[model samples]
Target: MKDAAKASGSKEQTADTTGDEGEAPAAKPKKRKDNKGKDAPHYSVKEPAGYYPILPVQVVPAAERPRVFAYASSTRRDFEVFNRYDLSQDLDFLILEIRQGSHSPFLLVLMYNQDAPDDTQQRGRSFERFKALALPDMPIVIAMDANEHHPLWEREKL
Candidate 1:
């Protein structure tokens, strides 16, 4: 019975010592304080040349053309008629090819009314229709005559 007690006591001591032997020492936790205005001086770095305002063409590919459709009222028929000329051939770059039952690549509705009533409403409806049917990324451009004057027809002052 005494031998058993001695063995048990020695076992307990062994267990306690062994348990602590492999454990690493506890490290002190680092405390972080907000420095705010107490931080070191910071320098304002200048951006490289032409970096402030990025050029649109630099970011946007030149070949990336958005589909556009141009609708013109009778008062603006001249614009549409002019579009048929060779000079107008390049206009396709500004418009997407319209596919039946498919949304236009992009929509360009031209308002050519001399004194058209509710023209803005019509424009809004057209925009909504395109938005509903067009691809999510498709772009829409609305080209309209300013007032009753045609800017393209004006002679250059220079």
Candidate 2:
């Protein structure tokens, strides 16, 4: 697992968030500015203490494999993991919420769908459950890898 960690660019270091005694006022989330073609700093993660390893992640299909795992960063003490939704084992999808600052919390859904005809029913049921779980008038972001070839998306070929 350690070897896999290194191979996958997982670090064993902790983030630095030390400061003075009194807590400073929390800054508003800033929109990232254009770098004018320059490379931006890569987002990195540090495995916190007592990190657990889950094997057989590759056992699932590549498109429907588990991707998102919520972890805490010592620096971002304002962020909180609220809820987790497990829809199905066959369909690889995860739904969770993370709240930051005084703003309304939003749902983050990580999904991957296979564009096969046989998977249509399972996908339909999963989406139905997803809709049922969502709260009205709340923000939701679905980050997905879909293998759909459609003219609407300008994908004329599969």
Residue 36 alpha-carbon offset, candidate 2, angstroms? 48
What's model 1's TM-score?
0.18
Q: CA lDDT, every prediction?
A: 0.27, 0.42
CA deviation > 4 Å runs, candidate 1: 1-104, 113-137, 148-158
Q: Please give each candidate's TM-score.
A: 0.18, 0.41
Mind giving the per-residue lDDT tens digits that candidate 1 earns over 1-158?
A: 01122333432111001123243322224322223532111111233443221111111212222132233233322222112111111211222222223444443434322321262332333333333443335455656443455667688832
Over 1-158, each residue of candidate 2 has an lDDT whose tens digit, in order, gives 22223354533221121112342322224422223642211222346674432221222332232333444344546666533423222334555566889999886666654432474454353345455553546688987665466677775643
Count of clashing residue pairs in every prediction: 4, 0
